[model samples]
Target chain A: MPEAVRSALAIAGKDLRLEFRTRTGLLSAFVFAVLTLLVFNFSRDQSLISTTDLAPSALWITVAFGAVVAMNRAFIIEKEQGAIDALLLAPVPRGAIYWGKFLANLAFVGLVEALTLPLFVLFFNVPLGPALPGVVLTLVLATIGFVAVGTILSAMVVRTRFAELMLPVLILPFMVPPLIGAVQVTARLLGGRPLTEVLGWLRLLGTYDVVFVTLCTLAFSAVVDE
Target chain B: MPPEAPLLEARGITRAFGAQRALRGVDLRLGPGEAVAVAGPNGAGKTTLLRILAGLMRPTTGEVRLADGRTPRDPAARRRVGLLSHQSFLYDDLTARENLHFTGRLYGLGDLAARASRALEEAGLAARADDPVRQLSRGMLQRVAIARALLHEPDILLLDEPFTGLDVPSAARLRGFLAAQRAAGRGLVIVTHHLAEAWGFATHVGVLARGQWAQLGPRPASLEEFLAGYQELVDA
Candidate 1:
């Protein structure tokens, strides 16, 4: 493996180990996701809005907010005891550090989504017979866009006075494009529309992922150092 | 590289935070095997200077360069420097051994397990290696942080208040370890308020007052002599 990749993997491993050991961020995020799903399941009357219509919005909403909760802890770990400085001072590339954090956030958000999907299905009675793969692809593609943006934004806001409040404020606006794309694709997939019908949204999500990931990686050093 | 080129150099480094200037036109040069100790009152920019040299923060003005002509901002050049600040820079949930192993991997060191074990043994924390850092005492955490900084054995080491949390025995061990590092041709820059601690190993001494050097030069002949000079400079 390339040295940079190796360093990034090491960082991701460290983060995962810390997450499992403390179970602080992941647990909170999971609980929040479950609660959001429950609220959506109960707040609406099935007689007015059908489960099929609400499922897409509910799932994406739960995932987006839950993701913010999870990504909030990404830089907080480094800020604790100022470990970020040591990570910055290492021989690894600055992009590697960003990539490491991004990878870890991706995993955390992905895991939360995985846990929520089953509960979402159970609570809302959404059908998943043939649309499972499409839904998964939509989740992955949309996640890459927001998580990429969130990783860097987390680093930027970590030093701010009200980081927890600051993160969602800054990240929510950026989440719009990808979230809309995700919701549209998910709604189509759940409505039994063929995958070909959602290709435009998928392409938009793919393009967003590429652009934001590259921009975030390139801008990470400036965000952390300055 | 030139035979006598300094391991690190800073020219007129001035760092300002908005309207408040923390450092003013500071100059420093550290050659191989040499140790420079910087002493200053609180808020005198001692840590700021160290951070700038470590490439953790960029100076508002001026430049810092490694012997190889690249700035410390260069990743390859950064590998040649290690910094131990007041914070342990360790994850509290990770064991001492795991922390060392993680650092070793970041530095791309070969034989990570062996290096981590050796570092744990050196810190005298081999017995407590498996315990999470949150379970360790302040002094033990400091020792682990010190071990992490020295794990890769960088050419230049930067320490800020290294002796703050150390016990007497650990302090003495650190002094001995620093002397051995000097003997091995590694350069070091230490920031401390304690005159004796700086006097113990610094071949050169600098007194900083209000972001500028009040006095900076070779070590005085004796601790008493350096103390007199230091007091006079701060008094002025």
Candidate 2:
């Protein structure tokens, strides 16, 4: 019931309500992700490339791009309505605003990923039965990394002329580290490699998440203050 | 004991964007029950000054402080200031009532429903409270924007060209509402180009030219006198 938490939740609730009313970001991202899975499924010859080998890269790529699409609106909506100024004028700490947007983006990307995971299975014939838990963990960590960077970068680019073009360009470079880490762990999990063997990748993802989330949170006030 | 300090004070505020200076050593002080009108030509930094005063932007030099000595950048101080800029700042997808409720919650106000309903009624948007902001006309949007700004009942209100898009009736209503706020002893700073309108309400008038205050003093006895004085200052 702390004020910060309450404020953050209020922000998240407002964003979620807006998204529910329009479903613009979620629907577009979901469709884009599904199409990505289908293209990957159809382009590859089943005999040459195994589903397990392709699934990790394809899934991670799809999620990353889909996440970018979702994050495109994270700050754009605020900027379009000039609501960012309203938000900045509030008494809440700037970090809470960043976290609120981060959480909302996380949920959005998670939803897209959840809906796409089933289609990924249907198209790739990759059994997620035993590896589900590990895959989920990797997805969560990787998403944290994606959204932390995306949330901050989205705010940075929202004011620019080429906001849509700028978001992916600015965010993709930072996303490389986390995406690589996620794909490797996902490949390992799908291949039945021991958890100990993929520990290093998980650690990398965790470090990326923790470092970027902290750095972005700290940097948000400066970015929006301008 | 010393008399209470002004509700808001800005000392030596200067702002520059790259090679261009927008504000130059501006000092302003507003006390309770005083409404100051700032009039300036285009590119005179009136909006910039208001933004700095609202804590939405940092000054290149000097600082803004509340009566309690908290800097404008302080969250606590921000809670005491309300700003209505040229931008409505309400979500196009959200209803008028929702916008008020959302802003009220951001300020951590209790009894949100009652407060939002009251603001809706005050702004005369009660019937259309559930309609999205994008569906409203410019005048209605301005009214809702006013409601949103006043939802928290801040001690100081900073308005930038609030009458820009309002219809005649809406403008008159806003003028009346702002007068009521002034009567209630809230400090106000309004930036506008409408000399006569500002002269009608402002207890003090300031003329900003080329990022500097060319004239700052009491309101002239008549609109004609104020216009003549303003023309003399600008022409000089």
Candidate with maximal lDDT:
1
lDDT of 1 by residue, A1-226 (tens): 9999999999999999999998888999999999999999999999999998999999999999999999999999999999999999998999999999999999999999999999998998888778999999999999999999999999999999899999999999999999999999989988999999999999999999999999999999889985
lDDT of 2 by residue, B1-236 (tens): 97657999999999999999999999998988889999988999999999999999999999999989998789888899999999999999999998888898889999999999998898888899999999999889988998899889999999988888888877888888888888898999999999666666788899999898999877778878777677778656
TM-score per candidate: 0.98, 0.97
The list of candidate 2 runs beyond 4 A from truth reads B1-4
Error of 1 at B166 (Å): 1.0
* Cα RMSD, model 1: 1.4
Give the lDDT of residue B5 in candidate 2: 75
* Candidates' chain A TM-scores: 0.99, 0.98
Q: Output the lDDT of residue B209, model 1.
A: 90
Measured against the true two-chain complex, the DockQ scores of the candidates, in the order shown, are: 0.91, 0.90
Question: In DockQ, how does model 2 score against the reference complex?
Answer: 0.90
